[model samples]
Target: MSTTPRDRIGLVLSGDVLEIGPGSRPFTVAPGANVQYADRAVEGGRDQNWPELIGQPAGVQAHYDLNLDTDGLAPFRSGSLDGVVASHVLEHVANPLEVIAEFGRALRFGGKLLLVVPDRHQTFDAPRRATPFSTVLTKHREKTTEVDEASIRDFCQAIYGQPPIHPTEVREWHNPAMLDADRLALHRRRSIHVHVWSPEEFASLIVCSLLEGITAWRLESMYFSDHFPARTADEFALVLEKVPFANPNELGRQFVDAWCNSVLDDTAIDPVRLARFEEALRRDCADAAINSLPLQLFAAKHAALGMASTQDRITSLEVELKTTQIRAAEAIAQGKALELSTSWKVTAPLRALRRLFR
Candidate 1:
């Protein structure tokens, strides 16, 4: 149906809309117009699909597996949608660049691509280092679909050391399930944070991607959360505008080159450092039996129960101490009152006479 003024409340909500990983509450731009919530699954059965994060169903128009969809938004005809919103969903995908490119492909010219990505510095991924654009490009160029052992080990090492208080659907990591040799299989079964980034790194990544012909989405506005969210805030939001790239101008070339250089300059990884990281991962992965779920869960429960019992004991002791003090005070007051009584002085003379007669 054609969008009318009554259908769209705002200027941006004029046509078809697609929200990837909308979870429970989807972003609604056009109230009466077609809006689709594209999720990996309806139920939280998929390993990577966090039904909890997305929450329960909320009138979601459509559901599809992002893993099987493979092409990201390519299944949708080019220039079909007016906008796409993927909130904190890109970190879980194996190929974020492809997903971003698909966003550009799916939306019509001037359409918006709104992305919310978690900052590693703020979330449980704090232990992890930001993923470089070169690494991302390699995965994209290699067309790697499934995660490898190295990624599994890296993720296990980072998350196990510092688990997210509110983890996405990948809750299995709360225990030692992530350290097992079969972790690669587990990762394949579910989604995990395959990449990490700060807001600056993310912006530079996008810029580099643009220079590499990954997408035509131009950066319109970027926001880094502050104050209430803090520097370690859970995530940052970005808005990109889909535009045609007929020819590259001098200004555009200079802009992309400068950003790319800045991003790449710091990304020159040291081989020795990387080897050390891998060695550390190996050490962590080797201790899978210790990190197993049942053992960890039992330990947590035991700790909690122990603390509760200790508190109860302390409270009992406090009550006993107060009662003892009250009894001692009462005895002292009774003795003082008897000594001051007039009857006690008269009874003392009679007691002396009785003693003399005896």
Candidate 2:
């Protein structure tokens, strides 16, 4: 008897199963067995080929938004699901901690969860731009546009540069209430990235969530490191097995938070420093602010239009301010020269009379 690839994969789990965000491509399961797949679009009366995709002899059940963090896990509690597979899905969720907790609840004791996600290290580094507090606030205000369903699509297209048809269908299933419009808009501006995880960070999140449960949890195995070249860019797979009890890493959690907070604080713009900069400009030249107004205006316009980050706008302003100071200094020098040339003898007699009076 020959074992099929699907059989090899399917053998990893022993009982009832759930797959999250299967998307258009479905995983192959064992023959003559039932598995359940959940997605938002499937629940919304959208056409889905889940039955054909699962391809199990007994067929598969489908649920919409079953795996969402906020959604109640009554379905899983109603019956035991031994396994849950999340593929490239965790990154999109607004609050991953909630989702992980739900997964911990859904799984039976000693069940397994398989997760595949993009490697944060492989993605482009988040941009380093310093923006003014006032500018950031103004940008946030501008983001509160009228909420039209089509507007969401248009915004998506504008940010992503085209309609991402494949991801859009699933993304639309996201409950509107779960999304804070203002926060989402700010996030879109910042970079559609809410979380970037290294392998250690990702694993730590899972382990911490599992500690809330009585079930013991252990990381089973990791797949596709250095061996598969294509996965080097986007994805890595982790298998976590349910256990009796596992200790959550309190120190690790604190460390991660402290590190991230330090990074953000270091990157923040210092208003006091900027004030000092303005004072220096004033002291260096008269009319410094006036002469630099046009450049400052240009930079402000660029920032308003979202063409430049706050840091870039500040740099532009500083350049203009310095130029104004230089021009003012030259004007003062020319004025002093004119005063000296205009009245030599007359000024001397006036100076002698003033000295005699003193």
Candidate 3:
């Protein structure tokens, strides 16, 4: 429905709008008053998405806050807000389902939410397995409120970006315990992109939630990377609309009827060409894995040898430190003995006289 990225963003938002976690670059500008909660920068400065040193974007207010997005706009009366906006916010939250529910609470029926998320395959998140729908439902059932250790580990694992990078097999030895400690430290920073999905994967979350009557939002419009062919932008923007009377009975039908007239252009992707692309990708990956294993094993051996050399250097430094401490202790004892002598007492007076003269 929209030709440009900016147009797609503007399509879903209008009137008195509330944008969540518009950290440093909010694209939406409404005719009515706009309010945005500037999210705390992820402190470690590792991830580029939510950075620590970035200056606050225009119209970003620190006062408009949530303890976390889980407490989403409880004070607003039902059917009060015209629109809600969140970009790259859902993945980091502990409970995304609750975040959506809270946003839906304040939005008037027919109000839209503009959600933009990273296309995992295009970002550093390429290595992560797509989160199963069941995992999302599980979090909703348990009412999860804290980021887990497992999530942090996946975020830490280095992944290449789009334009496939040839695998470089470099082996570095890291203690699993130390790595665990590191992951814990990064998690405390709270700037983790915990969930990842392509546009299609995210659509499932919205559609499935509506089907189960868990949420009142339905997919209205979307924009993917193809929309911007001149440049590379990994985020896929979603426009979701909230419908009225969101209960088990009417919610499912409301979602279904809204899409009754939907027509899909199957010609967009030629199935035979798509199949050839998939097969070629799989074949190349399998061949790379087979070729890399031998080199990887030798690299591990080389890394172990390097670790042994470092250990020997550490032991030599420890022995040198012990010898220096012994010599220093002996010198201190000699000075104490000299202070007790009659000659030293006479010298002490001479030293005091010299100090006064100086």
Candidate 4:
């Protein structure tokens, strides 16, 4: 029998599953299945009816105070959960990979991890650049705690930075007069969209993270929606499977090698485009390698060469300056000589006689 998106998701989600940030519109799992909801703020708290309060659909009531931003879903036992659903919740978190690893830790072997995040190009974040995978890696490695300030600024500035042209646009600019400290505190306390990504790039991030030992979740299936009939689709969904290999070193290497090979596989089908792609990759790889050099080391190597060029530039400038000074002096001397010449003497006497008559 054909199943709906909810049905498809529910099929694999059974037995001790958890859903993160299931605001007012939680995914339909089973009629009376054991599904625990988690969120930072729930109804009747300081941020009472928080999700609904913010004009969002408040899904299931939060039974656990699990915060994915600072406190990941790490309280759960390793390999204890059957599934995890984090729908449209990752973009608000500070460290995506940390939570991702926690998801893997919570799920049993072959358990499912459902994730959904906004597509920057299709959402209110259209004005911003996609978060680079390299930056993602750095944040993940560092276990970043605070919201990326730049991302918060970008978010606030993009939607509310400019004056509204139409009724549908933003109503007011984001606290233009507020101090930096106040602004950061507000964003930190509230939900902030921290990362932006395309579906393909997001998928690649998951895969690359696994390949690089940054995370243990394996991509199972992925989907992108344009939210058709609407201007843009806001979110992309993906599924991950938990693996239990003690040493994934070989597995990770194989995955990366196969992926690289697959990138080249397109050449057989689309030689023209593939050729250009390959050439671009070569150029980019070389640039990346050169750019990876230590800043100080690179500077030290080039210091002597730079000094030599600077000396040559100074010498060239001195010659030009001398030539200009000489020309100026010669012109001044010519002017002086002309002032005392016969033509000047005759003109000066005639001028004096005319002035006296006036």
Candidate 5:
């Protein structure tokens, strides 16, 4: 029997799962599952995307008062949860790294975190720049608690953010008149797409977060979806595992080594990118392990993806040589076949006469 995408995700998650912002459509990850929910403004919540929720007073009732943006898992004790889920919620939160870290704090050593965020290219955030991993890392490091104004502005402006239509027509765009103090406060409270990222960009951010000690979870797996089992487009999903490590450096280095090894297996990977990722590994050799990592800047595959390598160039040349040799052999065979098909019994005297006439 073929397993569905939901089934695959459900398998990764086990025991005491808390799904944030479940709204109207709560996933059935397990049979007889007592999955708890966390979301603010639960009384009047309704999701337009799910028609069943349209007429309901509350789409999915929140059983917990937990909030990711400010009081991230504050009600839950450390190492209490088996899995933490935040679906389509990160884009709305300003303190994503902090919230993620909070999730890590709440999860047990073998617990998991399932995250799904919008694909900037397919969403109203198309016009915005991918959120910088370094900036978020700094904010996490500083223990930032407030949403930045720049992000709010970008979401509100959303200039030419999607498709070939008029700039103002995008779903993300807000009227300039709505930019007053009270409205901005409400926007900051939640329900706006404030962050944009490609799958690669977000992957880098998550990996960097682990290395930077912003989160205790390591990247277990991730994928970008155009549309399929969920019938949703322009979204990427990630599964993270909370590993037991005495210090961030231990698990971070181990994860990097594994990533580098896996990347080497892919013959198509650009050597330069691989080399850069390896360089990050090397730097930790003589230095303080955690501090040596650039973390937010190209710390993983995404940063390494942007360069060239001698081995890759050599491989390219070898493929070219093989192609040239194949072409030469084909040309020679074609010439011989033409000669054989031209009537092999032509006389020398006829050929001489034809030459004389010319």
Candidate 6:
């Protein structure tokens, strides 16, 4: 059968299926059963028949909110499901690795798992913060408040009129109490931005997680939506195929080793650069301490020195200042004559006075 645009964009399923974190609108997969999982539905009601939108056959049944993750669906444990479609759901899950593992477990060998996640590089509406390791450590030492998951969810609901749901569970690894109210309040001041992954980093993490037995297999290919014309970045889809006979432990170790090596090589810094950074730090510290004296102290010291140096010159100015006073005396005499002419009948009175005086 010809694949539809949604299938090309996401999972192209042919039979029985599972859809994780479907939110409000579950994907439409005709001729198959679709199961969706989410935390909360719209207040008025939940869409029990959301799968009908996918135009499934009349006998096809739809199950909603099975809460599979909380229900203990293990990797490689679920009998073969033909396909799995997870769309815009991974970001809200606390442990995406476990969810992916569950998907791997549920799929039949050669079965496809289609994952769609918002590209952190392109998604701006989401709350995100990226801090360096040093800054993170510093904040930890300072005992700053942090925002937790529940508050974040509440914030999302308040701002976007939607409940905040984490797509991945990895963030929970950083702070498990993110869902709790009291704990959330303690960290509420600091953004609960526990994790934000760039496109490359996200792909690498997924690959590493699968290789590490967090999932039962590896991804066959990952496609980004941002580079749609040339390269997509806003959303990404990963096509994963189940590996029936793989050793979980060995695969995990090898994956970890490779991931570590890649990260080290990519982020490695030279000795010269390190030395220069340390030297710069020391110089900045010294300069900051030296410049820490109060402003008033500097102003007072400058004022005293200036007064001492110019004391004699200021005294000499007192004598010359007396001679400069003549200009003021002449100006005062002109002012008295103008005032008398305006206040009195100056034309007749002043003339009579002048005649009498003469």
State each model's C-alpha RMSD to the native. Answer: 17.4, 17.6, 24.8, 14.8, 7.7, 20.2
Q: How many backbone clashes does candidate 1 have?
A: 5
Instruction: Tell me how many residue pairs clash in candidate 5.
Output: 2
Count of backbone collisions within predicted model 2: 4
Clashes of 4: 5
Instruction: Name the runs in model 4 displaced over 4 angstroms.
Output: 1-7, 30-32, 42-58, 162-173, 176-179, 226-232, 245-358
lDDT of 2 by residue, 1-358 (tens): 3243222443576567788867655555445445678864323132242222234443244565553534545566832778888777666554555455456677877777777776555543122111122221232245422223333333343334324333554344333443466544433322233344544445434433433332245655554333344344355566666554433343223323332332223423222322322333233223532243233433433344343366688999999999999999999998888778857645878888999999
Backbone clash total, candidate 3: 0
lDDT of each: 0.61, 0.48, 0.61, 0.64, 0.66, 0.48
Error of 5 at 308 (Å): 15
Q: How close is candidate 1 to the true structure, as a TM-score?
A: 0.59
Runs with alpha carbons beyond 4 Å of true place in candidate 1: 1-13, 28-33, 42-61, 163-178, 227-233, 246-358
Give candidate 5 regions above 4 Å deviation: 1-3, 42-58, 159-173, 226-232, 247-250, 257-358
Q: Could you give me the TM-score of model 2 versus the true structure?
A: 0.44
Residue 347, candidate 2: how far off, in angstroms? 81
- Best candidate, TM-score: 5
What global local distance difference test value does model 4 have?
Answer: 0.64
Please tell me which model should have the higher lDDT, number 3 or number 6. Answer: 3
- Candidate 3 structure quality by residue, lDDT tens digits, 101-128: 7778888988988888988878778778
Candidate 5 residue lDDT tens string, 2-92: 2545436655776899999886676556555558998866233334222333456565878887656668888889999988888898877
